[model samples]
Structures are given as structure tokens and as C-alpha cells.
Target: MTSGPQHPTPDTHACSAHPADPSMAPAPDAERCAHGQAFEILSTCHEHIGERLGALEEVGRALRDAPELEQQHLATLGEVLAFLDTAIPIHSADEEQSLFPRLRALPTFAGAVGDTPMDCMEAEHIEHGDEKARLKAAIVTRDAGAVGRHAIALANAYRSHIAKEEEVLYPMARQLLTDPAAIADMTEEMRARRREAGLLKC
Candidate 1:
């Protein structure tokens, strides 16, 4: 495991004044992963995810109270939605594509029984996706109750999922994945993903 900043600096200006339209609101700070530190990057991503989940929960509470999307709530919703759409997928890819497969190939994990930790994490990822879809649909239909319910559900699920990864999965990976070449490859792949998404300079 590598040591670095655990959380990105939030762009306070983005939400300084609520926009008239939620879609017009600026996005949250873009989380950046340091080169050649794949596990650190993943951990940083978890921090960002936690922040977004907090924002989502706040949105849920606001909606529950008013049952109408206020400007501030919409601004927060936009940030949360954008994170779900973009950052979450990339983070998932970092785990599923880069880290999980490497761990699975290791002898310690190769002979594991049915439904490994990786399986559970992937399954939870799918569940989170489903919940996000429901939340988005509710937002589109202006269903305040449904939006609040789904947002809170998604936030809770993601928080638990993050905990499992941080506590069990990440430490396991750090212990097992000690190959320098493998770490380099994972770092390159992650950087490539960001470059392709136009989030990183080549």
C-alpha cells in the first residue's frame, strides 16, 4: 500500500451559487490518482465515493422534507449524478479489470471456494447500478419520494460496499499483490482509462 492524499479537494466554487437548472451546475472536483500507485488510487476513489454518498444522502433528506427539487438540492443532485455516471464506472473498472483479476490469479485466491470476495464486490456493483438507474428514473419523473428512497438506499449500499473493500479486499490485495511489474501494469491501465476519458493529459 502507498501513502498519499486520501481525498481530493472539493471545488467549493462549483456550488457557491445554486444554478437555475440543475444540469447547468458545475461538477464536483475531479479525483486524480497518482501514477504507479494503484492501490492508493483505489483508496482515494473510495474517499471520493464516500463524499458523493454523503451528498446523495443530503439530497434525499432535502427531498423528503420539501418533496420538491430546490436549487441547492438540484445542484447537489447534479454533482452526485455526475459522479455515478463517470467516476464510479472508472473506479469499478480499476477494481474489476485491474486489481481483481490479478488477485484471482494469485495462488492464495486461485483455489478459493465458490463466491469469493471479488464475486461479492462485483455483485454489489451491479446492485448499486440498479439502484442508481432507479434513482435517475425517479429524478426524471420528478418523483420526490422515490428519488429520496432510492438515493438513501444507494448511499447506504455503497457505504457498506466501500467498507468491505477497504477492510478486507484492499488489505488482501496489498499483502498478495507484491509484484512490481503487475503494479506497473495496473497503474498504466488506470492512467490509460483516464486519458481515454479526456480526464488526464497524455
Candidate 2:
């Protein structure tokens, strides 16, 4: 290890203002595998999702506080909507095809996986889709009150959903899946899916 101010002692403890999922990381050598790199992509998306949620919350607060929002505030809303439109299907597709299948294959997590965080998250995603549609409608109508209420609800919903994914789902997926070969296959699947969805570069 290079000795510098950058390297903290092993025993050093620091407070983190943000919630992070350590499970999303792979072992040092495992990073050579495409699945490990895919996790990195997913982690980036997680951060992106968090940012959009914050923007939505801020816009909702503005809408509720005042009837007339500045063009900048509306621009923020537009950005949030664009992010959601791009992220929701892709993120969910990855989970549905890759993570959930591997999770279901694990006997240890059978009932717990079905009933605990996955169940909660799936329900929230459905509700989130509905809320997003409503928000778009509200935006079209220029209904500030509708937009405000939907934004508040969506913010709360996303916060809960992301928390469960971070705290429970990602950890369980990491613990259950250990076959390097299988993860490699999953990574290829993610890549292919991305290409099919026009989410990947040629």
C-alpha cells in the first residue's frame, strides 16, 4: 500500500452522510469478470437514481410552497422525469432477469427472498409507474397541486424502494450467488439486453 494521507488506518472509523451498499462490490480479483464490471454500472445507476429522487423532492417542495414555480424548477422536474423514464425499465429489467433468477435459485433465501424485500420492492415499482404516469398527466395539465402531491408520494416511494434494494436485496444477492461462471453469463445477458434496448454503444 502506498503510504500517504489518502490511506486511512484499518481501525479508522468515519461517519457517512450517505447510505451505501457494500454488497454491490466484488472481491478484488473478481473484478476481472464482466459481472463485476456490470455491478459497477449498476452502482452508477443507483447513484443516478438517488440524484433524481433528490431533485424530485426539491421540486415537490417548491411546488407545494408556491403555486408558481420558476422555469428552472420546472427544468429540474423535466430532468427528473427523463431520468426515471430511462432508468426504471432498464434497472428493473436487470433485476428481473439477472438478480431475481439467481436469488430464486438459492434455497436459503427462498421464502425470505420472495416475501421480504423483493415483494415490497416489486409492489413499489408498480405504484411508482402509476405515480409517474399521473405526474406526466399533471405536467401536461399544468396542475401544480397534482404535481406537488405526486412528487411527494414518488419521493417517499423511491426512498423506501432504494433503501430496501440497498439494505436487503443487494446484500442477499451477493451472499447467495458465488458461481463465477454463472455471474459471467449474467453479465453477458446484461450487455445483450442493453444493446437490444439501445442502451449500449456499438
Candidate 3:
């Protein structure tokens, strides 16, 4: 990771506004898996998202005590906002458009679980979008108190959402979505999406 300016700039990379913090950088393996393996790419996204959620919580706590947005806080908040605006939508598409549909198509998927996990996951995605809108509004208004409140709320909700995917959905995906052709198609689709979004180098 490279250090960014004190103020946020519109950069292409998702975390381009942050300082050189190793913890805030995406996993190196994630870059390699970006265009190759669908499950690996999605799992790596979850890892990156988990890291950002932690950062969000930390910034929220700092904002609560600080009189105003400090330079570092501003940079961190910029990174978080950039991530929410960019990476999150792509990740959701990877799940909702690619993974979830395949999982739903599985013969074992319909009744194996009493309720549709995909429905729950999709609902939560919508809720997260709503929460993000609130957080962004607070940031725009320079309302430190509201920013802190909404940031923590978004982080907590995301953590729970990630937990459910990791604990329940992903495992099921790995087991049931086993056809090589299907996996290849999913990987290509994910790669195409990133390439089209200019997030992929190759």
C-alpha cells in the first residue's frame, strides 16, 4: 500500500486514499486469483471486506473522541467510502449474479435448506446499501456524531453478513457447485466484470 494525500482524491484503486498500512492492503493472493478462480476470488473479497470493516469500526471509535476529522481519519474514511462505492457492488454481483444463481440451481439447493439462504443474503445486501447511503450522507454533512454512529452500525451489520456467507453459503457453494464447466464459466464472468470495470490489469 502507498500513502495517499491528507485529503481524498478520486483514484481508481478502491483503497487509494489510505496510508501505507499493510493491514489495509488487499491480500496479495487476491490479486493473483482475480481472473482465475471464482470461489477463490470471492473468498479473497470477503477477506478484504473483513479488513475494511475493522478499519471502519476503528475510524468510528476515533471520530467519537476527536473534535473533528483529523487528517488520518479523513484519509481512512476516504478509503472506506471508496471501497463501499466501488468494490462492494462488484462483490455483491459476484455473489448475486454468479454464485447464488448457481447454488440456487443445484438439485440439493431447493429443499435441503428450509428457507432460501440466497433470499436472506439478497435481502441483507439491500439493507447494507441502505446503511451505506446513511453513512455517506453523514460524512457529506460533516456530522461527526452521525458518522460515528452510522459507520459502526454499517461495520457491525457487514461483519454479521460476512459471517453468514462464510459459515453457511460459501461452504454450500464449494460443495454443490462442483461442475468444472460451470466453475470455468463463473470465473470468466467474474473476470469479465472486473475487466469491464477497469479493475483488472490482465
Candidate 4:
């Protein structure tokens, strides 16, 4: 029998061309049969989020070091704003459009009605988007109040964003992605979008 690990596969595909996760523990047979793809995707998402959080931390440090805005600090602020503007939206959209819909399809997320992860995530995107705009303007206009407010907005949002995604969204998405068809669709959708956005190769 071809074991999962030893299963025949293509040479050019990613390590996940079959199914695997670096962060999650090995799934038991039943759970593996159900949520394997979700587990892998969740692991990758967490890594993505963690990396972004680290960059955001630098923004916080800059703010702390220079309580009074300085022109030199605009460079750091520019990096933070640009990252938030680009990266967060794509990640959030992947979860909302590709991942969360699959979750909401499952009976496990029936109670998730009205407050699906996608809906919550979309709201936060809009909220953070406003903060990003303010942060950019703070740099351009040299407005201390705007800088403080934008930094505070991102710091506050990161607190809740990481918590909710880790505690709520990851598990839920994992549960829903059990369906092979669902995972396959999500993989294709994400790959296409990423390629279009120049975030990935075809």
C-alpha cells in the first residue's frame, strides 16, 4: 500500500502537493480523514500572521522610542503602512472568500451563522484599512495625533486579530476543510489570486 507519506507525486509541486503541515501535530486517522487540509492551511496562515505581527512590533517600538513624531521616523511608518496595506488584505481575503465559506458550509459552524469568520474578518479589514490610510497621512502631513492614533489602531487590532484567528478561525477552518473538494477549490483559488497579485508563481 502507498502510505500517505510515500504516495507517488510530481517533482515540481510544493511539499503540500499531497498533504502535510509543519506546525500541527500528526492528525489521527479520523481527524486526518476530516480536517487534514485545514490543518496545513492553518499552519501556513499562522506563520504568515506571525511574520506580519513581528513587523508591526517594529512600528510599536518606533512609536515608543519617538513619542513625539519626527520626520526620520516616517520611513519606518512607511514600511508598516505599506505592509499593512498590501499583505493584510490578501491574507484576509483568502480566509474570507476561500477559507471561511467552506467553514460555514459545515454543520460544525452552524452556530457560526450571522457571525461567520468571513464577516468578522471583512469588518476588521475595513477598520484596519482606515487605520492604514491614517498612518500614511500621518507620514505625509507630519501629524503627531494621526501617527499616535494609527499606531494605537494597529496595536489594538493586532491584539484582537491574532487572538480571534488563532482561537476561533483556525480550528473552525480546519474542521471545514476536511472535504477534499473544498480544499482543492481553495488551493486553486488562492494560487490564481496570488499569481495575479505577483505574490506567487503559477
Candidate 4: residue 143 lDDT (0-100): 64
Report the Cα lDDT for candidate 3: 0.74
**What lDDT tens digits, residue by residue, belong to model 2 across residues 130-154?**
9899988888888887888889888
- Each model's number of backbone clashes? 0, 0, 0, 0
Per-prediction TM-score to the true structure, in the order listed: 0.80, 0.74, 0.80, 0.66
Which regions of candidate 1 are displaced past 4 Å?
1-32, 200-202
- Give candidate 4 regions above 4 Å deviation: 1-46, 64-68, 108-113
Residue-by-residue lDDT tens digits, candidate 1, 1-202 = 8985333221222112233322111223444464537887777777767777878988898778676766787788888888778888898999999998887776565566444678778878999999999998988888888888888998877877776677667776777777799998998898888888876311
lDDT of each: 0.74, 0.65, 0.74, 0.56
**Local accuracy of candidate 3 as per-residue lDDT tens digits, 1-202:** 9973332211212111222322333445556656559887887777777778888999999888767766797789899888777888888898989997887676555564635677777888999999999988988888888888889999977777776676567766776776799999999888888888888422
lDDT of 4 by residue, 87-122 (tens): 566666677778767766665556657655566666
For model 2, state the Cα shift of residue 80 in Å. 1.3
lDDT of 4 at 12: 19
